[model samples]
Target: MSEREMETTDDDRGMDQLHVAGVTLTGVARGGVETCLMAKELGVMFDIGMCPPGAQRYGTVLASHAHADHLGGVHYLASLRSMFGQKPLKLHVPVEAAEPLQRIFAAWSELEGYQVPVEIFGHAPGATVTIRRDVQATCFRTVHRVPSLAWVVERVSRRLKPEFQGREGAELKRLRQAGVEITDEHRAPELCVTGDTQIEFLLSDESAMARRARVLVHEVTSWEAGDAGAIARTRRWGHTHIDELIAAAERFEGEALVLVHRSMRHSRKAAEAVVARMPPSLREKVHLLGN
Candidate 1:
């Protein structure tokens, strides 16, 4: 083996073996650029108008924004509770969308004769909500034709270090005696789904789209533009450009970058052509989905 191969440390070696499996994201920008995901074990769905096959069973739904593609499927999820005789589905919405939706839920609730819960959680920018212990979600403010949100799903775990691998008893005693920063860790950033935002949001170092994720799903609509009015409209309407996405992934070393939400103007071939221009850093980690 080469010297470089010999020098790889155990942590690096074990990193490949880490159990990082997680939620299933599908129908994301697949048709109509709708982002629908199934938090498989968490038993919830995030966004669902362009619902994927077999996602009907998930009893909960979340609307990231007021877009028709993102939220048009909530009516279906609500129907499932009555159809399947399952419990009422939880629909989480941003504060702005929550009230108007609550009225709709009220009417639906009356029709269904049972209340469907509208869960308003982490609707505010930078607010965090724990959907469950292993799953926590946070929303970020984004620019869009309507008020929109970007989200991050974080996975948490606890493990003893190699040095303290077998020191459970004595280390536990000492830790009790001393106030150490003993806590679980983020196994990896599970997923970051950017609904729709302008180029500056992805490029901004301070934005939530920064370094805190493992898989990043961002929109790449209008990728062919030379960044003329496109950039201006992105600023005006709150959308992101592909170039800014490249820069963000490069800046933060995102493990996987999934570009989505291709506009109708860009054909599959056109999208691929634009993606071909990505720098190695961007090309290495970035992926174009549903092109």
Candidate 2:
């Protein structure tokens, strides 16, 4: 989060690091999970309908896919921003999704009388972009029913190397002119939002966004069915059972993992029982929500 990127409504209580992950279970007019990572450099809202009462805390909204739960809060933000005399917000999305999302925005704009800017960008998988360089964003495709994307955002840095810490001669001049190949690793992000995905795309090495990152926001729409047939059916929609979701988490290392979009059938106890059985390492990072 940068000072220039965000216009603080709370001058008395402004926060620099804006990171929050939430999933709306009900009462938001849509059924889905909405995950957002907020900061001054960039404020992105994943999914739509899952807005909590004060979701406008996120300045800009980014839609990971077109599902209502994921996208439900867009109209609310548009209306509020207009009332407050804010500029149109940019919503980054996949190229293929631009059309349908535009239609949704148009409908909302006409009804609300506020024209919000919808900036749909064609994401290059495994490539990088300067969404305010301090917060670089990369998008990778996920195995959802539709063409969904998962994003990884991390702070970027460049520092003078120990070997050339204070070189002020020709060497420093040359390095600056030639753009030294400084390997400033994009610091591992605090959040990784996987829209709605099946393990098929997640397990791919090409999908680096899925393989490594911190704080995974994945969809666990279904829990273990007492019957194998039901679990098999859940697999068809790219949904993972609690156990299988943990198994997938074990494949990558991260600080925390939040799972949302549990089926209406499963009780919270059922979701917890499944987590109670997970291996110790995976269990520590896993959080089951909206079960």
Candidate 3:
């Protein structure tokens, strides 16, 4: 079945929902307009575009950059959570953007006559943070006009050590009682959300997790592959073109390659047509997210 056939919409909230690779992604992504996505199963939200409905539920938000379309909703989310008696929101953003965002939140607090409750952490490329006991997030640098990051969430599990693989249950229990470490921790990349970045991000050496993630949410702002000038213009603005993404698609070993942050100039129908014309190998894994 096609990705579109498995997709569903939430018109009341003005969000598009997609269930792929065993996770549900909910939110909107329109270039220069708004771009927020929630991976509820991971208890995290990527970006906070205008703080759409149901965003308050996620205790943690991983922001890719400071663009208005991606990070504009930071204050709104914090305030909403406070109003509803929820814990202070935990927001993780690029190190370069952290202080500036804090200043912005201070300004908002002064204007509102109340402090906005939030804990913002600045993370540089290669930084990792624990989202939950089994889930963690790691950020990597992306090529963009401003400092930006692509977040990868990994699920960690423990498996029996190779040496103990064939051991009987009683022997394993005895080893455990004797304080022997019988398992090794393994981390698997589950989802990767690249906020807004040039195509160079995918080609970079630091993009291993983005390529290996089970689900990759990438931006393709320019859908017109036929226009070389248009593709050039998109790169100048630090965004990806469909042609660039298609060229690099095979490098991604993920189950779902979700294309998002499409420019308003192209309609959904037009974008779907572009996907249809792609090589079958790339087409099957590519899915569009947004109305």
Candidate 4:
């Protein structure tokens, strides 16, 4: 297809080839442009900047805030699912943006002449919802111009209680047969995706989810070196500068960091060049998601 025709197509917009944290992660993100990510394994997507006609495959989507770049495709996704007769889609949005989003959906539903099968949920920081069996999601505050939120997906499982660790199989069976509480709940931070936030969100103790996550997806809109003034603009826009991440490298404990939401002004080469200069300790764990 021609370039213009390609852009108008219902394709995933080049999001199909991505893989992250053992899941199919697809989508795009650039400052003031589209931004979205889908974790196929969890059947959940983060944001809805650009929706493919087939987004009904994503059973649940979490919107960080109401920014156009973050929620531009929400209506399309919901309408497509309803039109195609797919299972109901769940949209979890920040409490502040919930009403506005519902109104938008209501308008579309009226125009389409059919009730959209989308359920809107409002969540504030500290609210936890079970996404699936053994998987749960929690939101945390993110410092952005709008009321944004960062999400953490945790894996919850049951492990033998410390007191029962050394128990014999027969004893364990007996305890279980006796209805004893031989297992303890264990939760591990599996993934964290922050849409648009200042560096403070990553550096603060409140971001415990990011610190403990096995994989973290964060925004690094600008990495121009020696541009102190430019760095200031990043903070002013509620985005993080790469230098801040470098400065607080030791504080991050995630196994891998997926750096995304790059500014369109920076070419892929420019972004890679900056990554190349990162400290070896930090470089090895960074995955630059070029726009």
Candidate 5:
């Protein structure tokens, strides 16, 4: 897997762009401000940070939590799609935030004099949602101040079994005609997006799929280890520190470990300097998302 920075033109709506692991990630993530990311190839948007431009193009949204910065734009997304005559939006959020969000939509419906055309599905940890016949998303709990979850998008395909790999097309067709199963199903975890989480999420047992995904987008809000108590303070806020991530970097077996949700207190250059000082092996796989 290779990583390359993509130029963001006016059409990108101020979102940062990066291409890695066979997919392009476009969006912005800033601590306490807004965070939204879209994997166009997967047709899914993670979080709706103020519903930045071009967000309505995706029909499905997998929200990680109820934080305003992450989910504030949900209503706007639904409204924009409705205004343009697009299909109703499908939103999957944590079970705890589902009811309150529905109520918010109800109030919006009352104020607008029309029902909001958004379908909200509540999912608990370990729930899976089918995005398409060949694609699906699995949800898992993450440590955050709110009820947060991470999403792992996987693609399923069938390949010829080992015994049939050398068989000719005609023979494979014959085997199929004879009711023999000549192929085996393969599920590959393509992407994992953790909206906002503490370091514990990476250390938890539930992170198996996330750790193995081709692209892992995790949050790192605190970039500097100011003092002995700095790390603890960041954890108290339910955010991950760069130091914590560096220590556990080896646990991640992904092709790309993209760090995001940077706080305004730290400049991009400062973060880059920190990343540069990381161990070579881990630094090679680490990337900072957003401009």
Candidate 6:
């Protein structure tokens, strides 16, 4: 763990680096610097804080909000994808950021003397965006200084109807012939990525998707025992403090809980010490993504 921590570079470029429950999570997230996560298998990225050229391989990017620390590299990413002759990048963003982002792209096109191939889709809270045939991203509002969203990636599956569980194949065929629906669609939360939000977002019922996700990647920006005033600063800035995270450990039922976007003020050693102090079970389930 120590060696790996030391190896984390400014951009956190890697392939299939951190596998959690069949999904690969990799990114660079130091508070106020950058925050991005690429789920390689799903071909979906959560943010583009500092989009590395390699990220072009992912066909879609879901921007949580317009915060520069999270979506700063979007234009550069689009330009790179276009330059490499990759297919147009599909960007899913909050509805509020659509116009400004489009204007920025247009300006870039004018400045660079070429149009960047990019498709932008603005989604409102509680809206669902399809990522693929079996998978989709459900956007939910989160507490942030800007209009932000947390994405829950769910996979659609099918299960036999309760009444048809014991039916023989011939009987099932007969039922199908009669136009009976023998199977029910099931949606399971596979991964939840919270770009940057206050602790209340995770503690409230609104975050049910994150609580039930197989893997949760969340932001825990400030984790220091400075003073009462400093703790308030965390909340005021739309971030989560360390104490809040420790107190809310029991609320997370996910198989893995990844903590990212730690404050640059805290030393790596100090942050690890704080995580080491978590309850044994929670500690085992938690993985800190730090720089």
Best by lDDT: 3
- TM-score (C-alpha) between model 5 and the true structure: 0.94
TM-score of each: 0.77, 0.76, 0.94, 0.90, 0.94, 0.90
Higher-lDDT candidate among 3 and 5? 3
Error of 3 at 19 (Å): 0.8
- Off-target runs (Cα >4 Å) in candidate 3 are 1-14
lDDT (Cα, tens digit) per residue for candidate 6, span 1-291: 124323333243553257777787876777898877888667589888887635656668998899888899988888776665666888999999988899999999999998888899998989998887888889989899999999999998888999899889999999999999999999999999988898888888878888899999888888785566877999999998888887887988989988888888887688889878888999988887645
Q: lDDT, candidate 1, residue 224?
A: 52
List the candidate numbers ranked by lDDT, top first.
Answer: 3, 5, 6, 4, 1, 2
Residue 249's lDDT within candidate 5 is 82
lDDT of 4 at 2: 26
Q: What is the lDDT of residue 261 in candidate 1?
A: 71
Off by over 4 Å in 2: 1-43, 111-114, 122-129, 165-186
Q: Write the per-residue lDDT of candidate 3 for residues 38-125, one digit (tens) a residue.
A: 9988878999979886676777889999999998888988887787667788999999998998899999999999999999999999
Model 5: per-residue Cα lDDT at residue 13: 64
- Candidate 2 colliding pairs, count: 10
Instruction: Tell me the number of clashing residue pairs for each predicted model.
Output: 7, 10, 0, 0, 0, 0
Residue by residue across 50-77, what tens digits does model 5's lDDT show? Answer: 8776676778999999999999999998
Clashing pairs in 4: none
Q: Tell me the lDDT of model 3 at 19.
A: 93
Clashing pairs in 2: 1-40, 47-70, 47-71, 48-70, 48-71, 48-72, 48-73, 49-69, 49-71, 49-72
Local accuracy by lDDT, each model: 0.63, 0.60, 0.90, 0.81, 0.89, 0.83
lDDT: worst 10-residue window of model 5? 1-10
217, model 3: CA deviation in Å?
0.8
Ranking by TM-score: 5, 3, 4, 6, 1, 2
